[model samples]
Target: MLVLGIESSCDETGVAVVEATGPGVPVLRAHALHSQVDMHQAYGGVVPELASRDHIRRVLPLAQDVLARSGCALPDIDVVAYTRGPGLAGALLVGAGVACALGAALGKPVLGVHHLEGHLLSPFLSRDPPEFPFVALLVSGGHTQLMQVDGVGRYALLGETIDDAAGEAFDKSAKLLGLGYPGGPALSRLAEQGDPEAFKLPRPLLHSGDLDFSFAGLKTAVLTQAKKLGDGLEARKADLAAATEAAIVDVLVRKSLAALDASGLQRIVVAGGVGANRRLRAQLDAACGRRGVRVHYPELALCTDNGAMIAMAAAMRLQAGVQEAQPLYAFDVKPRWPLQELAAA
Candidate 1:
């Protein structure tokens, strides 16, 4: 079946076509994406209203590009899948509106996919993928969670952040150091030349013995250090970046290992934007390798929000016999939705 997936849950608008032959076999025909990173760069963060308007402008053209590139017309699509919730309401509505309209016009079925579910399944799109019954660490700007995945649509939330997400902390700390928006990548780049031992940053709740994480205090620590630096801040930026990165990586790796031991799962799937952190990946890879476990990640391009994951997720849901909503079905976005509440179709 040919599935058209639309993702506009956040700053990027993505559209893709995926073909699912059966349970474990899926092919990506084509995908297109439009990122609003530069658009919001001036603001130092995403402005919800601007993001929604941009999605309205780009979603259609992107869809057209994907369809044309894939040699598939609107009518050729069997299912229209869209990210339904867990994002900015206006952003979600843009994708939902376009998808539902297209589905209705083409007489195709439409399925509302959970945003994080798409992230969780993204690793499978790779040639080398992990099987079911794995641990998933979903670390993004808005969320940080540890989950146990037994199958598609089956997830058990083990723990999550009690405060700001790791990615948010990274961005916030970067901002304090005079780095601009989307600080994860920018700060990490600076950390390469930084001396990790130059500054000692606290690893909050590292030995909490629970899966839950807390980076709020760590971010505050960076603020305090920045204030103390006074006029010498410029010279110490890299050192601060390195210390922040090390502190975060340490907590994440330790918590991930603890989760693996608790779940007794040998395979770990790291998803969401923060999964693209090179340091985190390196640390997790080493830890997992030492314990005879494995780690999986989406391609770097797919690490953030993209339509390919949504398309692949929709294909999997269709293969699992998930049902589509009615043609007249219209629902608002969910700014806060629990993953465990998602039901199999």
Candidate 2:
């Protein structure tokens, strides 16, 4: 089956093609992505209206680029899949609308994929794929969660953030440090020059004896520390960035290990934008290595929201016989879909 996937869930517009034979992981043919980072940078955040309009302009061209790169025509695509929820409503609608239109025009079935599910299943597209029955750490956007994933569509939430997510902590902390938009990566880059132990930062819920996470306190601590730094802030920005990253990564790594222990699962998969952090991966590698537990992560390019993950996820769901593409054209998007709901999907 040839699946053409579209993703306009956030600031990036992406399109891709994947081929699924029968059972097993699918093969990604080609993909194209356009980042609205420059557009959103001026605003220090995403503007839904601009993001939606940009998606409208970029999706078709990106789709065409994917088709051309994949050496396949639109008619060769058996299913049109799109991110249907858990994003900006207008941005989600753009992808869903385009996918439904393409499906209707091509007389093919359309599949609505969960954005986070796409992230969860993305590692299957990597060279070294993880097997079933593993712990998954999801740290994307406004969400931070740990789930026991038995297989495709078989996910049980083990724990999650009670307040601000890890990504939020990164962005918010970076913003406080005078970093611009897309602060997570920017802050991470700056942290390399500073000492992770230069400043003491709180690690929330690290010893709570449960799998749940809380970064709100940590973010507040960063704010308080930055304010206390006064005119010395610029000289100590790198140190602060490093300390912040350390605190966030420490909580995430500890909680992930705890999740693995709680679920009695040795294999762990880390997915989402934060998974791209070198420090996080390095620490996870060291921690999981000591326990002889396996860890899987998506390729750096696939860490963010993209159409390839959506296509791969849809193909996997089809291969697992958990979902079927529908011929129906009418479609709706969920801007606040929960990952746990995939158990019922």
Candidate 3:
């Protein structure tokens, strides 16, 4: 079936068309995205109101682009899927409104997809994919979690950040180092020339023996280090970036392995924006390889928020018959929703 997916859970407005032929088998016909990163860059972070308004402006045009590119008209779209929650309230509503309206107009079914679920299933969109019963490490600006996946729509939260997410920590630390907004990528780029041993950063909750994570302490450690360096610290930026990256990667990798061991899941799937981190990928790849386990990652571009992942997830959910028939105006955005609460369709 052809599914139209809409995503506006964050700064990016995304739309895509996907087709599902069988269980765990989806084909992407076309996808289009509009990122408000530059708009939010001036504010150093996303402004919810601005984000919502932008989504309103872009979602329809993006949908049109997706349909034109895919050569599929409204009638060809069997279902409309949209992100329901765990994001900015206004942002979620934009996608929901458009999707619900489109579905109603087309006399088709609509499904509200969990954003993180889309991230977890993203690796399947790749040529080389991991099967069911795997561990998923979701690391993004707003969240960091480890989940056990037994099947489609079956997820068990194992561990998550108790404070700042790994990406947030990276961005915050980068700001302290004089880097501008969206610091995660900037910090990572600097780390390439950094000496990991130049500065020592704390690995918060590294040995907590639980799935929970804490990066607030690590951010403080970066602040303390910066203060100790005082002036003329520009030369040490790379070293600081490396240390921060290492510390964050260490905790994530260790906790991921622990989750794998606890769940006895040999395959690990990493998702979210931080999943694009070269160092994190390398570390997880090495750790999993050493343990004789397999690791999967979405294509680098797909690691960040995108419509393709949502489209693929929606197609799977539709194929599984996990959908609801609700009025177009009955939509609501969930700013905080747990992944474990979703039932397999």
Q: Find the candidate with the highest lDDT and give its number.
A: 2
In angstroms, give how far residue 74 of model 1 lies from its true place.
1.3
Better of 1 and 3 by lDDT: 1
Per-model TM against the reference: 0.97, 0.99, 0.97
What pairs collide in candidate 1? none
Per-residue alpha-carbon lDDT of candidate 2 for residues 44-160, written as tens digits (9 for 90 to 100): 999999999999999998999999999999999999999998899999999999999999999999999999999999998899999999999999989999999998999899999
RMSD to the true structure for each prediction, in A, is 1.2, 0.8, 1.4
Q: What is the TM-score ranking, best to worst?
A: 2, 1, 3
lDDT of each: 0.89, 0.94, 0.88
> What is the clash count for each candidate, in the order shown?
0, 0, 0
lDDT of 3: 0.88
The residue-by-residue lDDT of candidate 1 on 114-146, one tens digit each, is 898999899887777878899999986678899
Q: lDDT: which is higher, 1 or 2?
A: 2
Best prediction by TM-score: 2
